[model samples]
Target: MNFLQFFVWGAWLISLGGYMGRNLHFEGGQIGAIFATMGIASLIMPGLIGIIADKWINAERLLGICHLLGASFLFYASTLTGYDEMYWAMLLNLMVYMPTLSLANTVSYNALENNRFDIVKDFPPIRVWGTIGFICAMWAVDLTGFKHSSAQLYVSSISALFLGIYSFTLPKCPPAKSENKTLLSSFGLDALVLFKRRKMAIFFFFSMLLGAALQITNSYGDLFLSSFKEIPQYADSFGVKHSVILLSISQMSETLFILAIPFFLRRFGIKQVMLISMIAWVFRFGLFGVGNPGEGLPLLILSMIVYGMAFDFFNISGSLFVEMETTPQIRASAQGLFFMMTNGLGAIMGGYASGAVVDFFSKYAIVSGQSQLISRDWHSIWLIFAAYALTIAIFFTFAFNYKNGLKTVKEK
Candidate 1:
């Protein structure tokens, strides 16, 4: 269930930029706008569907419905040529697809609990397969030469359809009962009360901030590698020829890092683990800023390895934190809220901000008359991202407070 959930995403998420820029002739900002659809849907759909799963619908059923609908949209999107048409198609696609992320977790957790399994211990290994699925999709796309073509969308669409059908076969997860009957409560907006707590508020704030970094690499990392094809000396480089495969290293690293989360959380606590994640982001981007396909290939490989720590530490640990902190009645809603802050608002900020930065660097090169055909300064763009991550880490070190061990919260 988890594997196919991310396989659909992996097929197109990272490679779409290359296709958009190389084949569709999209500008940096337009590409960012396209990616922002996920953010927009993240902001709206997850919470709404989470509310449904919490009070009215079965999570597994909702997950199936969302994916089925998303598959249709993705299929239609594959046929689009115009930016406006593709944008709206993807927007609709994401609206249905984003919520399934939370729903999948809800279903999985409920199933695990029913089987008397420990989530913290068992879930990571199970979830690690999702990353493996992602890697498989990326490799499939690259090997088939679909990375720079619209074929990637078809790959995603088929996977979505498959997962949509498979979702209905999972164990049933009925809505949790809630006593209160109100409009806001029905929509699960009652979880908004989490903002009233100082600790929860601060954690969500940083979640949003750190979330901004989540998609930056996905948005441009492949494009960055493929851009080397324009340079004479590096035109034939393996990194340029198989950019999607190269970037899949990060996903491979994620599989490993996901397994390390339990130890990190127990030993260092959430704060330190997250702090380490933030610092790792600095290296993730810093290495990209200086690395190339030749002698600097090692730096790029290192960056990909570090990406595991940077991503898993915050995302997995944060999800576990939400699970351990919130009441069972609001558990799904709280998880949706975490997704909203990170992938929703944070993603929007990162998309536009990073796009603007890319455009600015490109404009600078044109203004300086370096060459009309010269591409944007990727080195500067990556360094700026590294600096942003560093600043967030420094502030997060002092701003969020928690102890050095996992504090148990009794499940209701």
Candidate 2:
């Protein structure tokens, strides 16, 4: 159920930008705003929800209820037309969905630890299935042609509905308050103090910057590939018709690359690993700037392959770094802080900014009665994003300095 929950998101998240642009006729800024809701909701609501689940409610029950509510909102969202209506519904849905990510992890880790499983060895295989689930959902959407239809929303809703009900069947996870009498310490906010450390501060700041880049492409890449449908010869091309499936190559690569993280980080150190991530982002965006979905499909494929390094290198390695460096007492809170900087503030800003940039590129297409036309300068917009990623790479290469060393803690 946990894996399927994220699978539904992976299926459509990257492709929706394209659908909105090519099929729904939304403005760029508006589309970005829709994606921004995820970050916005995560920023404000997840912690509060965590508090409720920890203190007063059964975590499993809360998880199930949240998903039921989220599924309904998503179903309602599919019925709406226009950016305004869609944005409101998505914001509501995200509020319900965002916290589940954390809750699911909590439930899984608690279950594994309680059962005395060898988490380090066993958990990787279990987690890898989540990637499999994501790939399966993406393939389903592409195969069914739901990537261009409102039915994709239904796919996610139905999955959420199933998971919501099934969550109740999981081993009971009671409120932690019964074990710990310290109510004041349960609030989980004190880790915010980590911002005081200079290195941690820099690490987190860059995290937000990179986080901004994370969803921008997801928001627009499919749309870019689909835009080729406008070119007559490429309209029925396989790449255009099955862009979501092709893009799943990135997720597949992600599965392989995550395994390489320990080796790469051990060999190169955090600074270089992060630098590679930034450089890969440059290529990831630049490939889209120059390639077409038809003859240039190889470039797109290469871009997807590199996506593993670009995404996993920084995010997973960075998290491990935080885990290694933080004091144990505040570790959980610090992790939340890390997420806040990256996925919360960074995502919200990135989502909105990417939209604005896309809209800027499409400025030539003034609103006609019912449709928007493409600008001759479409490629220019992609190049601009590529340039931004490159600039970040250059700055990171020079500005950050950390010794190259893999410091792994041996398991007992």
Candidate 3:
């Protein structure tokens, strides 16, 4: 079930940018806007859904129904031809799907705690399968040639449908009683109380900044590579021809990097770990700006290599820091709020902003016979993103007050 949970996302997340640009021929900004729909939905709905699942419904049942609804919306999205239609469909799909991310974590934690499992020891092996499932789905899309089609949506939708059904069979998690029946508690916004801590406040603010970078590459990198088809030499290149396979390197790196998190967090501490992530982002965007699929493929490959550290370092370590630093009673809510800042508000801002940048750069290009833009200043766009990362890194170093630069972890 965990495998399929991520399988649905892996089938489509990275390739959707290419599909929107290459297949639907939508404006880059509009495509970013479409991706932003997920963030926007996440910002609004996850807390509310969490409240519902906590108060009145079973987590497993709620999980099932959410997937069912999400599947229907995803299938509906695949049928749409334009950005306007797709935007609404995707928004509905994400509203249902976003909460599942948190819900899945909740379900897993609940089950592990109930069974008295050593989550720190056992969960990693099981969670590794989620990465395997993600890789499998990416490979499936590449092999089946669905990476650039509406069929990717169908693939994801079908997976979600099956997972939804499977979730019903998981251990039952029932609603909890609450003494306070106020609006905040009902909506699961009580987690907002964490903002009272200065350290957490700074941590969450940067999380939003980093989250802004998360979807930028996902929303445009494929289209960026595919855009090279405008140039004759790269038009038939293997990397261009098999963009999905090439893109899979990012996910591949993610899997490996996830395994290294505990060590890195222990050795370097959260500040340094997050700093490495910030530095990696500069390469992530700079490589995209400078590399092509042909002669520059090495740089492209390196960019994908850095993606693991760039992504996993910040997300996993940040979550762990939150888990360790915050009190146990509000850990779930703290995590939820962390997600809202990063994936929710930050993602929405990034998607829309990146789209605008891509669209702006695209306008200067001259399109020839094939849908390729000639000699456009894409380097500037990448450099701008690199600058953004650098700026964020600088601010974080100076502003986020962590006294000890490193900490050693004693494994139990």
Candidate 4:
């Protein structure tokens, strides 16, 4: 279930921007707008579905329904030629798809608990397979020459359909029955109370800022690699031709770094671990700015490797921090809030902001007395992003108040 969950995403998530740019001729802002749909959906749907699952529906059944509907939307999206049409189609798809992420986790946790398996000890290994599945999907798409084509969407669609059917076969996770059934409580809005605490409010604010960094690569990394094709010397380069496969190295690194998290957290604590992640993001973007496919291949590889640290450190660690801080009654909702802040608000802001940045750096030419946007200065763009990440790291170091110690966050 975990494998298929991310496999569907991996098929097209990294490559979609390239397809939209090359095939559909979408501008940077338009592409960003399209990706922003995930943020918009993340904002609205996850909380709503969490409420539904908490009070009314079985999670597994809801998961199945979401995927089935998402598969239909993916199919429709593949057929779209216009940016506006594809935007709406992808929006619909994400609206259904995003909730499945949380639902899958719920299903996994419930099943693990029911079988008396230790979730903290056992769940990480199972979750690692999802990253592996994602890597496999990216490889499949790149090797099959589907990365710049609509065929990637078909791959995702078929996988979503299969997962939708398979979800029903998972263990039943019934809604939790509670005696105090106020409207807010019924909808899981009780988690909003966490903002009343100053520390939590501050934590969530930073989560949104860091979350902005997360999807920049997802939205533009492949397109940036493929852009090298515009240079004659790099036209046939391995990285240019197989951008998705090369990018999958990031996900490969993620699996490794995930194993390192407990040690990092135990030794350095959340503050240092997250600070390390912020520093890694600076390297992630800086390396990309300086590296190319030919002599700089090693730097590109290093960038991919660092991406593991950049992603898992803040994202996974932050989730764990939320888990440790919140009470059990609002635990699920708190998790939802963390996701909302990062993937929802953060992604939305990042999408539009990055798009504007790309557009700003794009060069224009007067061709036959008609102004035309000719090329993007990718190096400058990456450097700017690197600078942005560096600024975030600096601010985070001074702003967030937490001390380093193994005793603080380690599970007893």
Model 1, range 1-412, lDDT digits (tens) per residue? 9889989999999999888877776767878888988899887776678777878888999999999998999999999978899999999999998888878888999999999999988997888778888899999999999999889999999999999998889999998885454445444466788999888899999999999899989988998998888888888888888888999999888878877888887778778888999999999999999999877889999999999999989998898788887888787668767877898889998888888887777742233532232468999999999999999999888888776467443322
The TM-score measured for candidate 2 stands at: 0.94
Off by over 4 Å in 3: 113-116, 178-188, 191-197, 364-376, 405-412
Instruction: Give the alpha-carbon lDDT of every model.
Output: 0.86, 0.81, 0.84, 0.89
Assess every candidate by TM-score: 0.88, 0.94, 0.91, 0.93
Query: RMSD to native for every prediction?
Result: 3.8, 2.4, 3.2, 2.5
Q: How well is each residue in 1-412 modelled by candidate 2, as lDDT tens digits? A: 6588787577668777777777788878888999999899878777888888888888888989999998898799778778888889989988998899888877777788889998887777877777888888888888998888788888888888888999999878888885542332333357767778877777888889888988877887777778788789999988899989888999998888998998988788878888899899888888877778788889889989999999999998888878877888888777777788878989998998887787776744546566575563557877887888888888777667667465633231
Q: Evaluate model 3: give its TM-score.
A: 0.91
- In model 4, the runs with Cα more than 4 Å from the true position are 178-189, 364-373, 409-412
Which digits, one per residue and each the tens of the lDDT, describe model 4 over residues 45-141? 8777877887889999999999999999999999998877999999999999998988999999999999999998999889888888899999999
Worst 10 residues of 3 by lDDT: 403-412
Could you tell me how far off, in angstroms, the CA of residue 277 lies in candidate 4 after the best superposition? 0.8
- Poorest 10 consecutive residues of model 4 by lDDT? 179-188
Which candidate ranks first by lDDT, i.e. highest? 4
The positional error of residue 301 in candidate 3, measured at the CA in angstroms, is: 1.2
| lDDT assessment of candidate 4 | 0.89
Q: What would you estimate as the lDDT of candidate 3?
A: 0.84
After best superposition, candidate 4 residue 218: deviation in angstroms? 0.6
Deviation from native of the Cα of residue 238 in model 4, angstroms: 1.2
